[model samples]
Target: MKHVVFLSAISLLCTLLVSADTVTNPPHVVQFTIDPATTHQQIDNFSASDGWSMQFIGKWPQHKQEQMADWLFSTENNTKGQPKGIGLSLWRFNIGAGSSEQGDASQIGSVWTRSECFLSADGTYDWTKQAGQRHFMQLAKKRGVDQFLGFILSAPVHWTQNGLATNTGRGATFNLKAQHYHDFARFMADVVEGIERTEGIRFNYISPFNEPDGHWNWVGPKQEGTAATNAEIARTVRLTGQEFARRNIDTRILVTESFDYNCMYRTHPYVRADRGYQIQSFFTRDSSLTYIGDVPNVPRLMAAHSYWTNTPLTDLKKIRQEMGEVLRAHRVRFWQTEVCIMNNDTEIGGGGGFDRSMKTALYVARIMHHDLVYANASAWQWWRSVATGDYKDGLILATPDETLVDGQFTDSKLMWTIGNFSRFIRPGAMRIHVTGRNNDPESATNQEGLMVSAYRNTDNSIVVVVINYSTDEQKIRMNLHRPRITFQPYLTDDVKGNDLKPIRTVQSGSVTSIPPRSVITFVAAQ
Candidate 1:
């Protein structure tokens, strides 16, 4: 209630100083109009990555693991009206590259960052590998989670040029060798088929690379990642698509997971680097060296993370606006596949420290709004599902560091903040055109205050998420002309332990008081 109390004191102090003739300014009323006729991208899903953390937490005691999984995957709600979990529609399964098998020899610092491979050096496949990850996948399915995307961060270490999953230094080069591209592609297809046949979980989409842009140097000992030029990425994707076709794998291939948004539309950082201008490089008909859009089953889609877009908020708007324009011109669908707090050291202290306040939630929620409304992103996914550290990475914060054994796991405002969009907006839901009278949220000049976005689900229901970042509670009017009874509001903010908790329902066409520093998802189902 920092915002509420501070504003209250200011009002009181102003009252004492003002004369009797002092009249109060009217509340800033926001007019929202939803146009169903002009609809945008069909929201594919809201998802989080399992990374390497799940391998440890999935093996925890059944109840503990269930609790964690329930928070991430459960679609049901308690009798008290609190959602059991955020009900993420898609779960990103990380395809390991044998980093964990290398151990100390791998040169990757964090044991938690290492991942086990299903394919060994002898060219033999082990379906039993990544047991912990499989356990959570089963739990997610058991909890009614349907969609899954298998994402590979890096090629297997044995196939890499350096015989390591990642480089120790920065370089504008593909980690995997040219001759091994086909083998790596086959390996990816094999993993997709292997998981379905043995683990009983069929991957809906398979991503060949994670942040394969040249701008990002994946020499980090902190985690596992690789950088590849656009041409190499295209060649690998083509090979992977061919393998999928040959094996009759039903999963679609997702390619060129750019590290950041700049790389997607234009060349950034290195002018000579071919990683930039990914949409043109990979999807357009002009560039044959990197064009894979025509490949069988490869969708006309581009995926990029929302990293470094936090600072100067204007950059956030500009980058997305430009990206949206390019994406529209190319007619390519976009998905914000991965993002966590980064590059904002002075404002939010970067992603170093733990949750000191609800800043992380509010910040991320704004970016999510822009991604869906501005960039026309069909899918949005976080970097990690469960964070084992003090940083603002994971949705659920686990205790005892590694989360290896049974430990305490706490819900984060970031998780519920994403839920404000994810929980209500289901797959196949189309984002209807929304116009605000006082301000256009997509406008760069309008940064603060109530940032809003609305989506119409497949069942003809509407979900509107309102985010109030200002210190004062803002009043917003919904001009939805649909026949609705009451709109339910689930709030997540600095309200002391509020995790998508339901508040009093409101009548139709009411001006709602959105609390400051809070994210409220108003669901009005027909």
Candidate 2:
């Protein structure tokens, strides 16, 4: 009886072991591959702007400010040999128009949204007023940010028809007075020159308008903004370019930051007539509107915001495909200049909630992949680098109080997920072709819920970013085009916290397991 009972107990133990293995570690049937020889468009750079959020955050304690700077622009590794921050290649500086000084009279209700202009309403130029913004700019340069752009949402309050920083009570009409066009151009040019002289950082690009297609009429205390006809934009670009040349400024003019992708190619009935059909309106050689493509100091690229239209996977793919087709035919590149989780129709509902979870991170990753792969955007930029509100808009969030505590700021997974691309895929990296089965299909929506993109740096280093949106772990049988290449993986998941933790090196044809709901970047030498 003792022998029989011992034998039965051993059998039960074996069964329990098998059950545990089945529950915890399931088999992976997904296989993916990459072909380096197959190539795609070249990637320019990735960046985020220090907009309204930076105004106050820059005045925080020195240590807190430095920490935020290092996280965004530090290319060097930490003492533990991990990448310190995303190492952004470009930095955007918001060129305010004296709205903040107006206080409640600025018509912009939120003090955070109101920005101070170097040229005050009294026509006195104060170079020192925007000290906080300048400090961040200097920090970016110190940390090796290669590109700088200055963007304006509204002209000075004195120059507008309503004499207010917020829009005139008109829909889709140019809020900026037609008489002040040349003055505005001069103001912008002077700003470009002053920054270079004072801060030792030259503005490489100046975006004169932001979302000009949207109605900016004082719709219940929104940010300072204006709408302009494409003709007016072309006029501004011509004048701005002429002024830059006259002043010997090397900064190029970036035109027409369209509100959405569809706005670039099609006309919305509610939108201003001159604001829509942007690609053709500005770039086409034969259009009646003055062609700004050949204008001095104007780049051949067009920029648009990646908002609102990032949902219903099918629409995302179709609009991007159409936009890509138009751009390719015209030989003009696209830059997805700005994005944040705004519309509530996303996979994760968008809100002002300061969520630091992977859910928001994964949603952003999917949008980034779509922009790069489908739209063929040379550069991808986030809306705000830091935020003080409980909004999903910021990559990093801080407390609303003017003072900074020890742990007042929080870094979201969105920042690290973006880092997976920006930190590794440095500037001048060419996006190479990556074809595979299981999860690597080129569809807007994949059954496996995996999105993958590959890039090759100028030095021929390979970087592959894989996003697993599903709940099940995917076993990818990676078949590289080259032989004997070893890859190290850096993961941004709940377990690893966006650190580039290296697992065992795997050679070509080795099976790699991608954790569920994670973003993984694999780097390999040529």
Which is the leading candidate under TM-score?
A: 1
Model 2 alpha-carbon miss at residue 11, Å: 54
Error of 2 at 174 (Å): 1.5
**TM-score of predicted model 2?**
0.91
lDDT of 2 by residue, 78-118 (tens): 67556899989999999997888888887777778989989
**Where in model 2 is the C-alpha error above 4 Å?**
1-33, 216-221, 402-407, 437-448
lDDT of 1 by residue, 142-212 (tens): 98888999998788888887887766665657788778988998898888888888978899998888877
How close is each model in CA RMSD to the real structure? 8.0, 10.8
Q: TM-score, each model?
A: 0.91, 0.91
Q: lDDT (0-100) at residue 345 of candidate 1?
A: 38
